[model samples]
Target: MKCINNEFLSADTYKLLKLAKAKAKDINYKYAWVHKGMVYMKKNDDSSKIIIRIEDDPTCMSSNLKFLSLNVNSYTAHTASFELLVTETKPHIISVVETWLNPEISVSLNDYSAIRRDRGFTDESGRYVRGGGVLCFIHKSLKSKVLFISESNHINHPEFIIADVTLSTGSHMLISCIYRRPQGDLLDKFFLEFGKLYPHYNNVLIMGDLNCNLLKSDRASNHLKSFIDDSALFCVPFGSTFHTLETDSWLDVIILVSKDKLVNFSKSKPPFIDGHDFLICEYKLGSQNHYNKVVKFRDFRNCNHQALSQTLNERLRLTDIDPEMIDLDELVYFFLYQVTTSLNIYAPMSERKICRPKCPWITRELKLEFHERDALYKRYKRTGCQNLFSLYKIKRKELKIKLMKVRNDYLKSFLENESNGSNIWTKLRRVGIVKSKQSSPLDHFDADQLNKFYANILKKHLSCSRDFILNLPHLYSKKVNFEFNWSKIDIVDVTKNLQLTLQKSSGKNPDRLDLKWLKDHIPQVSLFLNLIFNRSLETGSFPEAWKSTKVMILGSNRKLKSLANIVLPQIIIDGNLIPYVNTTKHLGVHLSANLSWDFHISQFLRRLFTEEDPEIRRSDRLAAKNNISFKMPNFATTTYEHSFVVTAIRLWKDLPPEIVNVLSLETFKVKLFDFLISNE
Candidate 1:
């Protein structure tokens, strides 16, 4: 067991080494290693070499020897009152041994061990003596040989000790030891004396029992606050050193370093203890060879209260004893599961109902029956489809029905009382009706009187505008396609040759179609075209192939002619066209045009003769001549009219032999027109 424990500790140490290396690489620092009692050094790509052995007294020799041997380094055992030497050329690791004689006599390396020693002074009664002291070691590389020490003697205050040392390389280290008063007025005097002596050193660490919790503020806490305010010194991270077991207060402190000089330092939680707790302050020295490390808990065996509790909990969890026969904590765990399951089973279906059943005795009996049913179901291996699940589902449905019945009964009661003043008004308000005042005899009117009053009001405001009446015929006639002279055509461009061919062959004038007409009629054409394209896009049929059979573009209107031009190109460009053409036909023509044009023109013309506006009347006369002069020629009569009507008719006609023999419409139309005119 001891060997296994040692192996575990070694594994932990290896993990720490890996963590340190990762941290060093992240921060761009050069060297990092574990420092046993014997120091190890590696410089400039060379293997590690043993540099020095820190001497430990007889008290710490056993653990120190074990640590050094496990780490595989050589060390010389010695006892001396001198400090170790560290240089700036490469990173150096130092290990120190010190005795701890506090609430418990434990190793100084353990973070939870409190080093308590008394001062020479005695209390007023002389029954108790103050003679406790703490031993601290300073680790740093210095430049000079001589060390400076300062002490303060203040009234009713603990003495303040400050030490400054410079090594052979001229780098410096300063250490401050403060012994504070146990109680009363002496604490204030100690802080004032310490403040007076603080400013003279750089790279200082003030560590000792100051008898104050820096983590919290209290009436007695002002002394530490004042000391920090007056001195240039600052506390490091992991600020709390002493933790009270009873109150869980962090009282005793070890403040270290002038804040600006210390860098790359982190803290960890103090170890658990029975009576008192302690924190460790770990830091590095120098600018270039700064160490990356931890100030962690070392010996924590003395505090066993929390540890014992944890052990007890674990034992209880693993034991086979019945929960009902066990202690309160174990019983709580068992009962909580029962209550959670019961609540989950009922809560969803009981929205506004009381949690308890309407009849208390029934609820108790039902609960007892449920337990029996659950036990039987579990025994039968029918946990899912058996008694408990079926009962829960039935209970939910019954509760929903009860709730609905209550709601319907309440609404029925409200509607029955509807004749009283309040009830009548309320009923009217509910149905969104407003009540008016009762009329006097003089204000009463018969049907004839009402009709005459309405007529007078209507005649007073009614006046027809000339444009509204006279323009009605043109608006109405606009819906019907009247033939126009094909000679009036202009703005023809061959770049849109397909569109031009479709328009000319259909005998529709493209120049007369404006943007407004196109905007209004395009959607209808687009919708039909979308239906045709959707089929082609899905079935892999070309738009022109569909156009040959299912869809037909037949209209004398110029807008409809322009729409055919617009939709055909859009279909080809969007890749919705099918490759093969179907010569056989299936469907009749689907007309895409405005139905509103049929009615609007007739209404405007009827309003013209009765309208009052003279200016509108004159404009109406001009629009009628210019817009309505186009006549619809009879296809069966005159030869010119026959040619014009034939052009419109041929769009829907089957290809004849003469037309099929021609290469293009220009070739066919020129020959047909000469033949028709010469024969006439």
Candidate 2:
């Protein structure tokens, strides 16, 4: 084999080569090469590049019960590094202090959802502002709610935000992120509000940059100590020894409800340049599952498609029978059974492990530099040598530069791709925005009230009156009659409709039957369905089993809780005023009373309105106004309404006044669907 030549290799590769050479000498070989974690050698010398690619298994240190807190003086400066650590570590929760960020600034975390409280300003022009800010990021998988402290209105407290976290252990905990300035005026107010709020929450954690050195016997430290003692809180005193900066004074603190509550706690030095050390704390939430269940999916790419097709055709041909002998329902069952059995024999599904890429920017070169910096950091910590610290800082800076280059390049390429064709707006939505059915986190005290609220709304919307229908004009009747399709229901049409519906199936049915079965026996299944549907239409009734329906509740904003009080529990559906549900999917569309769509729109508008770049928002408005045609990529075509902007625009543009203002909900739905189909 021909081989390329190289004069030198990377330091890591050189080290690996030396080790391989030493091993080869011991094994009575002239040369060796390490490939796929195994050594290979040739008797004859051959010059080569000696390039080896070693793929590291990116570790994701996620847990159902993990919390992290850090005080980076200027988070914007080190956000990339922080995000790198966060993505790899996958902490359940993170609290950041001294973010020095403004409301207009966007901080994106792919795996975590963040809420921020920037330092309040006093000027009308909004030009003058303070530097300190607090931001919190909770893993997207966790159930968390952003809370606004009511007392902030009455008293001037420091920048802080409270979050209600539902632990995997089934217990709810409240976490507060506080950033107190050294000025000390708001310090007193912070304590007062915290003391008042403490009574309301059972388990609590308050962490931030307090700017008070506990080691000093001074009044500020002593006062904080007294407050902690009185409030029945425990302070993790690593603060006294773990210096936050080169100043060699500890100012950061992690306060908990009690000392015994913390199952695991440790402070570690981060490789990145930062003021405060990273603190990881795990609370013992009794009986909570910390690890997520590993979900594997079948690798269908390797399926025997030719064999499956042959088996499916054979099975379908064998099942042919006289139409009169077997009814449509029986034919469907038989066809499905055959197709399903064929699939099992030829293309059975299996579970396989999945490996997700954690950090795309972590190249081998950057990894080596990071490891070097980390080693220097450890040596510095152990020996307390200023030289090691300096060397660590140099490597850290170089690593940061490399990280920035990789991030910027990736972002540049991403923006270019996203901007190509119709992806500009679509990919922007994917950045940090999520559209979901909004539901408020409800306490047991208010659960009944919230359920009743949804039950009332659904009842009001779904219920119809005979009198109201009778009052409609004869012209309306003519419109409805004209709109109806009078085409005769036949075997061919029924078969075609069934085929189309099966193609659209999302594979979420309770029955194990899949699309392959229906596709394989379309002729038989279609004939069967046509007969069944025709009979049902002629009889003016559907089977009771087919007539059954499901209801989904949308979550609303907490501020709308008072609206629930107006809804009495008189309305009953499914034998309950309101059925118990977390979230429900109906006809493939997720629904909730909070109707997260409304909340999503509000959030979208909030960001849109506050956006510093007027051009971006202006373009969005223009796009909406012009009713621009947004062609979705093939992959994205499955679900196009992933963002509030896209969804709101589509709904608004399609539903004209005639359709939207229709008095009858049934009519509105019919017209709305027609409009959507025509547009599509």
Q: Pick the candidate with the highest lDDT.
A: 2
Provide the clash count, candidate 1: 33
Per-model CA lDDT versus the true structure: 0.36, 0.58
lDDT of 1 by residue, 349-448 (tens): 2223232223212345556656665565555454465666666657656655755675466456656754456555645443334444544222454433
RMSD per model, one decimal? 39.5, 21.6
Error of 2 at 243 (Å): 34
Q: How far is 520's C-alpha from truth in model 1 (Å)?
A: 93
Off by over 4 Å in 2: 1-293, 317-336, 355-415, 418-451, 457-483, 488-680
What lDDT tens digits, residue by residue, belong to model 2 across residues 198-268? 88776888888777778787787788899899889998766542454355656777788988777777776
Candidate 2 global CA lDDT score = 0.58
TM-score each candidate: 0.25, 0.34
Which window of ten consecutive residues has the lowest lDDT sum in model 2?
475-484
